[model samples]
Target: MGKYDLLAKDIIKKVGGKDNILSLVHCVTRLRFQLKDESLADDEALKQTEGIITVMRSSGQYQVVIGNHVPQVFADVCRIANISSEKEGGQKKMSFREKSLDLISGIMMPAIGILCACGMLKGLNSILSYLGLYSNEDGIYILLNAIGDSIFYFFPVVIGYNTAKKIEMNPFLGLIIGAALCYPTINGVDVPLFGHVINATYTSTLLPVILIVAIAKPLEKFFNRVIPDMVKTFITPMLVLLISVPLGYVVIGPLANMLSNGISQAVLSVYKISPIAAGFLVGGFWQVMIVFGVHIVLVVLCITNIISGTPDPILAFTTFVTFTTTGMVLAMWLKTKDKSLKQIALPAWISGFFGVTEPAIYGILLPRMKHFVISCLCGAVAGAATAALGLKYHTMAGMGLFEIPALLDPAQPGVSLVRAVIAAGISLVIGFVVSFITFKDEEPSQTKGEEIVSEKCKKEVIASPLSGKVKPLSQINDSAFSNETLGKGIAVTPSEGKVTAPFNGTVMMLFPTKHAIGFMSDQGCEVIIHIGMDTVRLDGKYFEAHVKEGDKVKKGDLLITFDIDAIEKEGYSLDTPVIVTNTNDYMDIIAMMESGSTVHCGDDLITIL
Candidate 1:
């Protein structure tokens, strides 16, 4: 193996090798692994491995947080391990928390830093103003405001660049749209559309930037369709540039701005009438939106509010969810049976300290359905309190550990440091107390008689990897993940538990993070069994595998089993997804009539049509 291979191999072995991982993803500098269980990962060994920088367990992801050179390392891992991007059957259904983390991990990581910086700066400004140290008319104050405000003002450009990179669009085109939004000519232009000329400012607006990129995606596809192969790559981009830049200004840009303004107005109206109500709504649903990338839409509103010199009320309330999740993390840390979980809970708590809730929620807290309620109550209470107090955060930084002098001010009066702290503390107390009191330490199980199924699935069913509630593919909110591309699928309803394979196959590859598994069937179909939304960071310690590489078995074979009690103790999800990758080759896929049913081994699930 080359250096990359050696590095990948070393990490893989430490993470439980080929059989332990379920799935994998990467950011600019990190390899995010979804492991079958958390025990399989050897954090100390991984740290000692060559070519790694650091490891972080955050946002329910066991992130081998490598720096800038991570993509190459990830690619090497995939290549040597024969990891496939496509699954064997349909995609598995995932919970809202699991799905939300996936959306935020990539582009949002960078954006978060900026948000934090801006928040810190805004907080400092608030304090300075409160102390009467400087007036808003001061040049230094204005310059500082511009400095912190630039990222939010040109958010479209930043989002556009990231989105283009993520979907393989031209980064330059994204820049063009971003620049256009920042352009003074375009900013002041009033285009008569419908009954009025658009009076929109592109600065600090979210919708125009995202909308332009959204429009550019289809346009890029359209251009690709028309452009010939010989000059395709270059020509397609060029053509898209010419067409999209103008349309972004004339059509998509204006439309998106209008839509964002409308949303902003709606939010304001809600806040004005009842700040507490608005806070409750935002606090409750912010995480839900993250599940499907819908939160990105609200970002437009956030930017709009910020640009108008009023920070977003929704953004302030959103922290309630994180704080609540943090409390759950604390509770879980005190509750699990597995040793691996005890180790993870510490880091998750650290992340929670800095207000990075994904690791806690996806890694340690949200897996248990009952425990999740504790966090929800905490969120609701925190949100209600924050709103009732009319507490506002002027900066965009994260809460918990990331809390800094720049992000807090007690004198602003509407929303101040004392209020934010009180709300957050109350939320933590509620979540921790509820979780500590209510969470059952026992491993989840169903009575033998309780495992009843519909008559149709008697012979053709696949038992769920974990027991919980089952939901339909259509109900899953991620656009990037759908039934059509995920192949034939089933989602397990699990508050928490062990996950095992339903059929026999060669374990293709496993991730170091221990959040997922991948296998190849006898018929050459690829399969992926992902545990939870983003529990890749657990590193497989909580998972116990029954088989290893080259193992051959029939249906109901124990490929892997999980420690639900351990997972819950760590504050993570046990919602499992079993998906087949080659569904496109099949004529039809049939699901058994077992809605709201419990299943067991050797059961029939679907017939290939």
Candidate 2:
């Protein structure tokens, strides 16, 4: 009877049922499903489901878009379906590119937020030190610095744990191996092991720990299968730790370091060729890289550059992109006459100032193709200008206006800050001017203060789609329905299984499990008829669809059939909700059938104006 119980059941059924699901996990806003057969999933049905936003198939994950409420839905899904959330064995094969992207994203995504916060904190501390408000010797300063540095200092342990989980190995054993690499006694000391001298420290390094954990996966698996269960727990971890740590320091660590160093040098060489060209490339294409989830590579490179020596100029050169996006959104907000567009653009503009450009990019600019291109061009110009001025950051941190603190150098007074301000000014001016001049509103405008009231309000009545006892949608157990998020409507406790069309219209969405159907009335009202709460857990056992998406139907035409008694016996409520999904387009929606009254198919159930 939880709020998301019915939704969870519906999702499980639409995703090829519980048997098709091998493993499931959720991150931020997506439900990542690893299915036994990906093709068996009802992609369209899940996309049309009420709570779901969209569906994505990326990096071998059948991702269900659930917005911010994914965690709640994910929990309900696990409980209702009785499936483990852990990474399962015997995963389906994926392409090399897909596997690489998945591994990198898996390890970096979880830590990026914290890393950015730490970087911002360090930037703030530098600002304070420059202002004479707090010296480096101050307790507050030391504590703050330590807080910022902890993640990087113990970077190996963090990367080791995540990489181990990504590769399906023992995470604790990975942690032990990571810890061994950073242990003061072992670090910087040459140890003769297996005719090799191992003398490497893994303190802020990235590639070495990842390589070590990747190599440990098969070794751990070998030990698990061979060792007896009674001694497997201790022996498996011990062997993994003893072997991976020494080999990592002696071979894997050194080799990975060499590769990382080589790549870092190549990037530096590119920058040295013409800093202006390098800046233009990174600045212009950075957001594009972000869309494809490849921007993390740049972040890795910057971190490696900093670890090797000085902070790279790549981050510094690209700082103007966020500001450029913000400027474009501001221009759109000011130029657009549409109320809705202005509403979205205003908040997106504010977010851009703080270095979060996703809203501005996805919501405001990208939609207007020309505006997005203009912003990127402006970013490139600004980047070229910054490069010409030779501005560089000593540390990586948040971008946009917030990045100014990071750009400040204590050794030189006001030089980098002045250059940063000039770059931001150029980016803002170009973005605002170009977007304001080129972008045009294609949507038809509504006149203000010219309300045309019809002398007689026209009413359209929707016939009942189900034979049931009437109930208001407010009384439903689910808030998504009860609160009228989808739209205002009514519910019914079905006395039978057959669902007929309430009006003549095209079928918009028909769930593969036959539990729900969405219809657009010929009169233009969009509605969804959802049958039997939580009955989707039955996995199409008692329900059948008479029509598919895009089928046209007349009033009272059979659309779906189900076994009412069979569903009720499974402890699910047969209270079906018929909702007006496009309620905003109408002035009002009023229920016509009396609560608790018996209603048959084609009976007037609700009236819309």
Best by TM-score: 2
Candidate 2 residues 1-609, lDDT tens each?
Answer: 667999998888777667667667765456777775454455666766777756767776787867546668988998888765544645655679867766776776556556666777877777777778988999999999898777777778888887887677778877777777778877778877777777776787889999898889998999999999999999988898888877788889989988988888888899999999989988888878655545667777777775554667887777888888888889889988989899878877886787767667766676678777878888888788778878766665655677776666646536767777888888888888888888778855445213322311356789999887999878887555665655789998988889999999999987656787889877677788878665555657789888989999999999998888878888889889898876766789999988899999989999989
What pairs collide in candidate 2?
none
The whole-model lDDT of each prediction reads 0.62, 0.77
Compute the lDDT of residue 436 as modeled in candidate 1: 74
How much is 67 displaced in model 2, in angstroms?
A: 9.8
RMSD of 2: 8.5
Residue 565 of candidate 1: its Cα lDDT?
78
**Candidate 2 residue-wise lDDT at 539:** 59
How far does residue 141 in candidate 2 sit from its true spot (Å)? Answer: 3.0
